[model samples]
Target: MSIIVDDDTRLVVQGLTGSEGRFHGLRNRAYGTNLIAGVTPGKGGQDVEGVPVLNTVAEAVSAHGANTAMIFVPAPFAADAVYEAVDAGIATVICITEGVPAHDMLRIHTYVHNLGVTLIGPNCPGALSPGKANVGIIPAEIFTAGNIGLVSRSGTLTYQIGHELTQMGLGNSTIVGIGGDPVVGSSFVDILAKFQADPETEYIVMVGEIGGDEEEKAAAFIEAELTKPVVAYIAGFTAPPGKTMGHAGAIISGSSGTAAAKKAALEAKGIRVGTTPTETAEIVAGIARG
Candidate 1:
């Protein structure tokens, strides 16, 4: 019962001929994902260790029934790649390329929404449904299949929390790195809704950072909608105001997007907030054990 990806995911790598794309695409395939095809213009009819490489996404979909597209192209061409995937009928698109212009993403986000397609990231680590599918760049080895669902803005922090939970013998249903870009494709509420409805997911871990009102909005959603228990960890507790942190969206404007403010908002909604990744995993462990 994983959201976004599962055993049925037939994926096409958009930049499969490039070094980054080839490396991670094959890695995902090795992790057991059904890598049905690859897309590399001017390199059609080729193969990356046997995965068929086509010139366009439309060819991949029309021939191989590829429903998912993973984009590893450079930032300059990433948005057009997304448009190609969506127009070609790819159900889900995951863009791992970072540094995509915000305006380009702004247009891509609206376009996908209007077309009723799902987009994962422009700077994301991708999603993983342990033992089922690995869509992006999330490390597959640290995960085990279980009922815990995780959604995070920070990719590395998502990995840290996932590693901690695995060490505590807690497995995950799905781990979604929604990317830390300001205008990402998915939001915490969007992923939370999916996790809430997933039958196999029993618990959720939301990792937020200082930025926007995303965490605050997610707190509202959790209180009003979600029935499963959620444990949260907010990064950037010490980030100075008016400055951006590791993520472009991770900036503090006065006190509106401060870590303390976000934590308070969630705690007020009865969601336990953890000060650190390890502590957050410990809290989930206690809840799961109890």
Candidate 2:
């Protein structure tokens, strides 16, 4: 069984009337996700690709039994959307919007934890269980069901590594994009813990970036808590200091969010850290084979 999503998971689009929302919603339906409903406050009566639209998440959940929500709301209002989804008892929420205000995420994060719900990302691409269900915007073509559990902070890098793994005949149990937002929902450690408990997951691939100390925290967790082999990659080797590095790339106060620091932290705990996305697959395969 996959940790986050599977074929049995039902999906709903929070901003279904919008272009990006509609595009991905349709793709999710086509890719075999159970696209049950859509939510667009003012466009309530409208239909996006035959999926019924409702004004609020509560209505959608009541009408369609949607347990998962994919939010396409703008960054400014993403927090409200997430709050609504969780308040309405949507068990899992995937917010795909980027650039959410830090304060907004902080409040929403508290709400999520309080409600005892699982939140994936406010700026993330989402999580996908290939051949089962997908909630978010990762390239569905690059995935398949297998024993490896993959999680990443970089959207495109996760896709690249997953594609490489597929090409090498190594598939994933679940691939999750924890998002790149600094204060967004979930973390490498969060996914790692879940993967650790998942029986189908034989190993984990954690992709991180320079910025905060989240990777270091995950390294510590790996050293103490996890028994499975963990292969990792942290981007932003040449990224300049003080830049956000595209999604919450872990910002340090005075130091640059450099790749060397993150790699060193993980490697110290016996976790293999890859230098490039291409090498991540090779390292994972090597670990699994060993």
Candidate 3:
């Protein structure tokens, strides 16, 4: 079983008429995700990839029973799109757009939490439940359904790690990219808690990067509550101090958010920390073998 999304997830693409939405939206549909409807203001009565498009999220909900929203609008209007999704009572909202103003996400994050809605990313790869549904932009090729649960902050790293697991015959129950933004909707601890409760998930591989204290906090949570084995890889090991990596949120301000510091914290919590993605997969493989 997947964490937030499953086979029953009825999806609506918020910017289905736009380029990003049309591109990934069709791919998601091809991966067998139920693309029930689309939302593009003034583009109501249109259809994208054979999915109906509505002007408002409420219309999509009322017409097609859409519960999950895949947001692909440009950064400028992305926040309001999310607000519209939440306002319409969407239970899960995954924002795939990047460069959204931090202040906008800051406000939306608080608002969504109070409403009990789960938001995946403001700049993320999205999520996929292999053989069930593909909600966001995670590649459907490398993933195969099995007992492992995966979460990551880097989209490309998510694919690489998933590839490693599939190659090792360690398939995933679900793979979620929580985004690399400083203020993401979900945290590593949140996804870790979900994997811990999932009976299908026997192991978890978290792909974090050098940026925030989220990894350290997740390590503590694993020590205190999780029983499943967790192997992790943190990117940007050699990233120059104070230089932002590929992601907007990947900049390190001080020694506290260094890859070294994050690795030490995770290792101290009895979690196996890998120096590379391949090594991380081997670490989990060793545990599964043991």
Candidate 4:
């Protein structure tokens, strides 16, 4: 079973009238996601592909019972959109917009955590439970429903790993790109817990990048909490120090957040740490086969 979304996930597209929103909303709906409502200011009475547009998230929740919110608003307004979704009692909110100011996201992250709401990204590709629903912009065709659960910080890497798993005939139960923003709402520990609790998730794959202590922390969580086997790959092994990498959060401030550090941490926890994405996929595939 999937953790955040499934067939029962009635979703609302926060920026449904915008270009990205209009495209992905239709795609998600066509892929069998329960996209019941749209929210766009000044376009309340309109419809995007037959989905009713509301001015406020509160209205969407009230009218359509939308429990999940997929945000495609512009970066400057992305945090406010996430705030509205949380304040409206959206249980799961996925913000796919990139370049949200870090300070703006910091406040939203704290607010969502305090409210016990699940927020996926502010600069993320979003997530999906294959054969069930596509909440964000993840390509639906690269995955198939099975036992492996994936969690990643990079969007492109998430897709690459998914493709690798699919090629190996190892399908995924859920794939989450938590975004590489400095202060994201959800972490590897959070998703790992959900995958551990999910009966359908057998083996797991975690994709991490250089720059943050997030991966090391997940290793600690894995040692103490996870029962399922996890194979991970940390990007940017050769990245020069003190430089910002591909992700907003990917910067090696010191030796603390380097790829080597993260790899060591995971290996210490008895979790396999692969040097490459394909190798990671093959390791996970082997574990699944056994």
Instruction: Tell me the number of clashing residue pairs for each predicted model.
Output: 0, 7, 0, 0
CA lDDT of each prediction against the hidden true structure: 0.94, 0.86, 0.89, 0.90
| Candidates 1 and 4 compared by lDDT, better number | 1
Error of 2 at 113 (Å): 1.4
> Order of candidates by lDDT, top first?
1, 4, 3, 2
Q: List, residue by residue over 1-290, the lDDT tens digit for candidate 4.
A: 68888988999999999998999999999999999999999889999878999999999898889999999999988988988888898999999998999999878878888989999987888888998999999998989999999999998888998898899888999999999889898999999999999999988899999887989999999989988899999999889998889788999886768999899999998989887888888888888888
Question: Could you give candidate 1's per-residue lDDT for residues 150-201 as a string of tens digits?
Answer: 9999888999999999999999999999998998999999999999999989
- The best candidate by lDDT is 1
> Cα lDDT for residue 101, model 4?
92
| Angstrom error at residue 258, model 2 | 3.2
In candidate 3, list every pair of residues with a backbone clash. Answer: none
> What lDDT does candidate 4 reach at residue 58?
97
| Candidate 4 or 2, higher lDDT | 4
The TM-score values for the models, in the order shown, are: 0.98, 0.96, 0.98, 0.98
**Which stretches of candidate 2 lie above 4 Å from their native place?**
248-252
Q: Worst lDDT window (10 residues) for model 3?
A: 247-256
Alpha-carbon error at 11 in model 2, in Å?
Answer: 1.2
TM-score of candidate 1 versus the correct structure, residues matched by position:
0.98
